[model samples]
Target: MLVLNGPDGKFVVDTFVAPAWPRLKEALDGLGNAPVKCVIDTHWHFDHTDNNTRLHAAGATVLAHENTKKRMSEPHDLPVLYRGTDGALAGLHFDPSPVEALPQQTFFDTCKLQANGESLVLQHVAPAHTDTDIHVHFENANVIQMGDLFFNWMYPYIDPSTGGKITGMIAAANKILSLAGNDTKIVAGHGPLGNKADLMEFRDMLVTSCDRVERLKSAGKSAQEVVAEKPFADLDPIWGNGIINSEQWVQVVYLTL
Candidate 1:
């Protein structure tokens, strides 16, 4: 999450996972009594928006892309593929988020806010990570919070069920790179903070991996065959160590393609 403090007040980006709201509140309390004027959700994912209710209840006006608000307002199940007790791939489900946690303020392509003496720009990057994904740029601070559109050093999870795609992910990364410079600090959705170079590397990785997977698929290879071929073997050591493992990453990309 990105928090900016200036003359106006305090502004927070992304509420983090649901279970961590209390800890977030405690940390916020320690920051004195600066009122939270706004809370922005980069997307509708539970991990990014679960604390909306608490923050909103505390008087923060929650804002997000229109798609995010719509997604959060309904019941949508997330698909989870994992190895079962028999060591075979199995599927699991993630229930929809609570309606109270939905964002009240929604925008289409872009939204701008002036707070804490900073200019905050939220720009939508569609069909990447999720349909509701957005990039939050604190212009005065030279920091950009790239919601789930960037995964830093890890293989990103693409939710096709929500309009996420490998190609769109690459496009989003490129868009961020275009907006950033050498000195800009980038706050990724997960993993460590990064800069333009890191984003470039991530974009390259996505392109190469997608190309490899596409080639295999074009040759009439099955998803299991593509996985066996280890299309992203070279990248697994560095980017595959995050929440999305190598095998799971392969499956998602292959299925999406």
Candidate 2:
């Protein structure tokens, strides 16, 4: 969803859904024919990789974490996408991505790249939102693009199916906070642009939620029972406004704990 105009050609970071491809293409075209030289997928999520094939066909090399390519090459079922008639969440299935859409290059731990007159530092975090989560730090610009590790003010979708851990989420936030400065621009995978303060609040929220959920689970409470208690009722006004409600967030936190 971000484009960087390098001195030679352009570089892109993440992408939108398939329906928005033309607009993305137009945006690239408007840059006076500087072909997209590279595309980076922060994770393997479909929302971030949907336009990979198109960009690849346009002569861009796709890059991502090694696990991202592995995840994309297999089928996945996410239960958060839909609610069933039985009042339970139904699975939203994703088939393996086509070979053309898979990343052509991948790194394991960390890597650095220079583009658009900026030094980009790419670092992969431990499993938080998903196993493939990574962050791109534009050192010169003082901007950090975190795929799903920091959700700004919204409650995040923690995919337990893909090695997401609440503790890992907390650690990721702490790591970013350590790297960010007062004036740094923190780009989240969801919600509005954030700052160190916003990320601090988010990290605090996750800590509080994790503590409460862990306590309830330790007391032998069921996940549904924890949801019924609405431990996050006080914090719901901000984080709960997203697709995940307080009740649902409680469930998610419980599972991860």
Candidate 3:
């Protein structure tokens, strides 16, 4: 977990991967044991929400999009550490479970909250990365926790299984661009912090890469052919790494476009 002490209060971003109890402790520790009145998750991913129970136990109100709470409530494939019972969580786990309990505060479209004097805006851009993906904007701090919408120096994963389409990913980037300005600092679900320029580049890469895949698909090329062609030949070397490789990206774009 990473800690950012804002003017109003403290922010413990990026929790554990499996949503364990200890990870919650780590997040609290990062805040210097400060009373966390509010908790904002970039998205509903385990790494970010695994500690929700612990934070809620400490009087911290967890905030997320309505869709996020609905998804978390369902029986999905969350790991044993995060799940209440056994048997693979299955895809339905995307919704809430009895033990998980949905986020207390839910917002659709856009909503803003003020705490310790800082104003934070939460927006729903789900079905972009996943059905529940949301972006948190720290207006006063000039920083934004982009959940999975923006990944710097790494491949951005668009989970097709959860309705994550490349076109939606492009829309997410555009939404970020709309909110971000020259001096805005951006924090992705993964990777290092960056500025608006970096985000613009990231968006461009996705647009161009998806365009390449669309062209290939129109030509009636097979998925293997598209992968072999390496359509992202002119893209940054790092854009094809992590879980979303060039091949996988081609597949997603083909399905989405």
Candidate 4:
């Protein structure tokens, strides 16, 4: 977890999770006895928000998109899949947390937060990542914490079942571009950090992928065909190394579009 101290002396803690909680607390301790005032979660993914209980208990208010609140408060069935690794012995199971607490405040379009004299802009940019993904902009500091919208190196995961769309993905990227300049620091949900140029590249990739998927759809191509068709071959070398791959991406694009 990297702690960046804002101009107002407030610390913007990043990547607060299970494995990193001890380290995060240590970092906070290093900042003296100043109690954490607020904690702005980029999104409601368990990895990013499971520690919300602890933070809230420590006097920090948790914030997230309206959709994130809804999703987190709903019942979820665990996912179990068998890996064809030579036998039935290889498999994976995922058990998500049951509906619990939710964000007290949620906005459909945009919401701004002022803390410790620092201004933070939270904007909903969804149908691009999840049903309610948002971007946190530290306006004065010229830094944005883009939840899952901008994955620096890995292929972005588009949750199709939750209204995620390829077109919306591009629009979300453009929205971020409008809010930031060339030198603005971009903290991605995963992977390395980036800037405006990186954002443009991500936007362009989404646009190109959208165009490809649309074309394929118009050609009466099936989902299988779309997956088999590697329309994003150009981006494979740069952003295709992850659990999200060209085939899965194409399937999502085709399905969503």
Q: Pick by lDDT: which candidate is best? A: 2
Which one wins by lDDT: 2 or 4?
2
lDDT of 2 by residue, 1-257 (tens): 67778566888889768998988888888987788999999898888899999999989999999999999999998766323233444257999999999999999999899876889999999999999999999999999999888888989888888888989999999999999999999999888999999999999999999999999999999887777787998999989887677777787788777
Return the TM-score for each candidate structure: 0.94, 0.95, 0.82, 0.84
Better of 1 and 3 by lDDT: 1
Candidate 3 residue spans exceeding 4 A from truth: 1-14, 19-24, 77-98
The local lDDT score (0 to 100) that residue 203 gets in candidate 2 is 97
lDDT on C-alpha atoms for all candidate structures: 0.84, 0.88, 0.69, 0.69
Model 4 agreement with the true structure over 1-257: per-residue lDDT tens digits:
22434444444433456677787778777886766665666665666676666666676655677787777776543221112222221122324443333565567778877765667777787577767787888877888888778887677766654577777878888888998899999888777898999988888887888888898889998866676676888888887786566666666667667
Query: Which residue runs of candidate 4 sit more than 4 Å off their true CA positions?
Result: 1-16, 77-101
Stretches off by above 4 angstroms in model 1 are: 81-92
Runs in model 2 lying further than 4 Å from the true structure: 80-90
lDDT, candidate 1, at 187 = 95
Distance from true location, Cα of 141 in model 1, Å: 0.9
- For 1-257, candidate 1 gives per-residue lDDT tens digits of 98886556678899998789789988887776888878899998888988888888888889899999888877676655444222433243556666668787899999998886788899998588888999999898899999888899998888877888889999998888888999999999998999999999999989988888889999999877877888887898999878787777777777666
What's each prediction's clash count?
0, 1, 16, 0
lDDT of 2: 0.88
Best model per TM-score: 2
**RMSD over all Cα atoms, model 1:** 2.0
